[model samples]
Target: MIDIPDSDRQLIDQAIFLPMLLTVLQRDLAAIDKGSFKLKQPYQISIEAIIRDVQKDLAAAKRYLHKNNIKIIRGRSENNFTFYMVMYKGGEEKRSYFNDKIRNNVEDLLDYYLVGRQEER
Candidate 1:
C-alpha cells in the first residue's frame, strides 16, 4: 500500500491537482471552441474570454513555487512497483490537516462555478 504523509499531501495537491485542474479547463476551452458555431452571438465571446482567464490563473498557480517548493522522489519496491513521495520546504515535516481546509475552500469555488449549484431564493 502507498502511504503519503500529511505534509506531502499538501504538496501533492499543489503539484498534481493544479495541473489536473488546468487540464480540465483546457478541455472545456477546446469544447467551447469546437461548439462556438452553435452558441448565441452575445454569449460566445464572453464565455471564451472567461475560460481563458481561468486558464491563466491555473498557469500562475503552477509557477508559484517560490516558498513551498515541491519535488517528488521515486523508489522501487522489492516487487518492482514504483512509489513516489512528495517533499517540500518552508514548513514543519509533520502531519496536519490544515491543508485540507484550504483544499476544501478551493473545491467549494470549483463546485460553485463548474458544478452550478444554486441557492434557493
Candidate 2:
C-alpha cells in the first residue's frame, strides 16, 4: 500500500477525483469521436460537457480546500503523467508535500473508471 499523510488527503482527493472523473469523460468522448454508435456530435458534446463540468468540480474542490484550511493550487489535465499545473497554495511549500498513496489511488480510480468500464470491444 502507498503511504501518505492524512492532512494531505484533501489535496489528494482533489487530485484523484477530478482525473478519475475526466478520464471517464474522455473515454466517452473518444467513442463519440469514433462514431461507434450514436451520432458524431456526442463525442464533441460529451467532451464539451466534461470541460464545463470540470470548472464546477474545480470550484467545489477549491471551496473544500479552503474549508479545510489548506491552500489549493489548480491544474488543468493535459494528458501527461504530470498533467496538472500549480494554481495556488495554502500553508506549506509545495515542495514540502508529496503523496504516492494519493497518486496510486488516483491511478487505480482512473483505471477502474476508465478501462474497466463498459466498452464496445
- Give the number of the best model, judged by lDDT: 2
Question: Candidate 2, TM-score vs. the true structure?
Answer: 0.38
The residue-by-residue lDDT of candidate 1 on 68-115, one tens digit each, is: 475554434334233445455533232233445545645654564354
Clashes per model (N, Cα, C within 3 A): 0, 3
Question: Each prediction's Cα lDDT score?
Answer: 0.50, 0.53
Give the residue spans of candidate 2 off by over 4 A: 1-39, 72-121
Tell me the alpha-carbon RMSD of every candidate. Answer: 8.3, 7.9
What is the alpha-carbon lDDT for the whole of candidate 2? 0.53
Winning model by TM-score: 1
* Alpha-carbon TM-score of each model against the true structure: 0.42, 0.38
Query: How many clashes (backbone atoms < 3 Å, residues ≥3 apart in a chain or on different chains) does model 1 have?
Result: 0
Q: Which ten residues in a row have the lowest lDDT in candidate 2?
A: 88-97
